[model samples]
Target: MLEVKDLHAFYGKSHVLQGVSLSVGRGEIVALLGRNGAGRSTTVKAIMGLVSAQGSVRFKNEEILGLKAHEVARKGIGYVPEDRAIFPDLTVRQNLVLGIKDPRKRGRWSVEEVFSLFPLLAERAETAGGVLSGGEQQMLTLCRTMMGDPDLVLIDEPTEGLAPKAVEQVGEFLTAVKKRGISALLVEQKLSISLQISERLYLMGHGKIVFQGTPGDLRANEGVRKEWLEV
Candidate 1:
């Protein structure tokens, strides 16, 4: 559903992405795996037009590069940042309401649907976002993105900073989200978690994709893992 071809991005004079290219088929979960400073997040930023970039970014056969962030979001793309940017003062429901756009749908997202997916969030519907735990905040962020009814969601490190049990819950949540036929480009440090959920994997290093294969192929290829991902 999305294709990034020979993408190049820069922050000031420091070049980041160097001829980076990858693709995410419709209804598929693709992992963008790489160590820190490998330009994984920058690629997502460039695709969303959050940063200036040179090259082509096509989503659902339409060019996305050079469009504003909101414009990209309007074209059926949603982003859940690594930092989980929740509004500190807004109630859990209110924060979700802000992220729930795409008025073409029936009610965007019914409160029942959200609560069903995240029972914890349901119980804290009126609580301020600042008071929620990290795991709760993560669930809220993902639920808010889902409320937008996006075809593709770029998720950056959804399980980071969570306890083991919470991490397992996150993995389950992603699986459920994917079952809804939403394509996802997951940028994560935990290869095991990503492998459990993604159909394909793209191993990146030094701002370029060094390996692209199925999850099983990636798991068996210890040489590539050692050279790029092992730290």
Candidate 2:
């Protein structure tokens, strides 16, 4: 459903993505793994047009490179950044309401449904987002994006710094997304969770994809893991 070819992105003179290429099929979870400075995050940002990029990005057979970020989102792509960007001043419910692309048409997910999925969020539906705990904020960010009913979600570092329980909840959330037939390109540092959930994986190093294979294939090739993934 999503294809990126020869994608290049930059921060002024410093190039961050150097011809990165990858694809995510419908209903498939493809994990993008790498260490810091490997350009994993830049790859997604480029696809979303958050940064200036020169390359071919096709979603559902349509070219999307250089489109505005909101245009990309309207084309059925959702993004959840590593920072868990949420409106601190808004109530949890209000934050969720903002994610709906069109309230007139029902989407695959609803606030009530997601709140039921994560009762922690349901309990704090009226609470201000700034007052929520870190894990709670993460959940709110993810659920808010889900409220958009995207065909695919670009999630960066969902499990980073979360407690084990929160990490596990993130995994469950991915499973729920898959059950709803949503594909994702997950940029993550947590190999265990990625290996457990992803059908295929790509490892990036220096703005290039160094490895592309199944989870078992990734495990079999210890050299790639050692050189590109391990700390």
What clash pairs does model 2 have? none
Q: Report lDDT per candidate.
A: 0.90, 0.94
Q: Give me the overall lDDT of model 2.
A: 0.94
CA error at residue 50 for candidate 1, angstroms: 0.7
What TM-score would every model get versus the actual structure? 0.97, 0.99
Across 17-90, the per-residue lDDT of candidate 2 in tens digits comes to 88999999999999999999999999998888898899899999999998999999999999999999999999
Instruction: Give the CA lDDT, 0 to 100, for residue 26 in model 2.
Output: 99
Which structure among the candidates has the greatest lDDT?
2
- Which ranges of candidate 1 are over 4 A from the true structure? none
lDDT of 2 at 105: 87
For this target, which candidate reaches the highest TM-score against the unseen true structure? 2
Tell me the tens digit of each residue's lDDT in model 1 across 114-138: 8887889989999999999999999
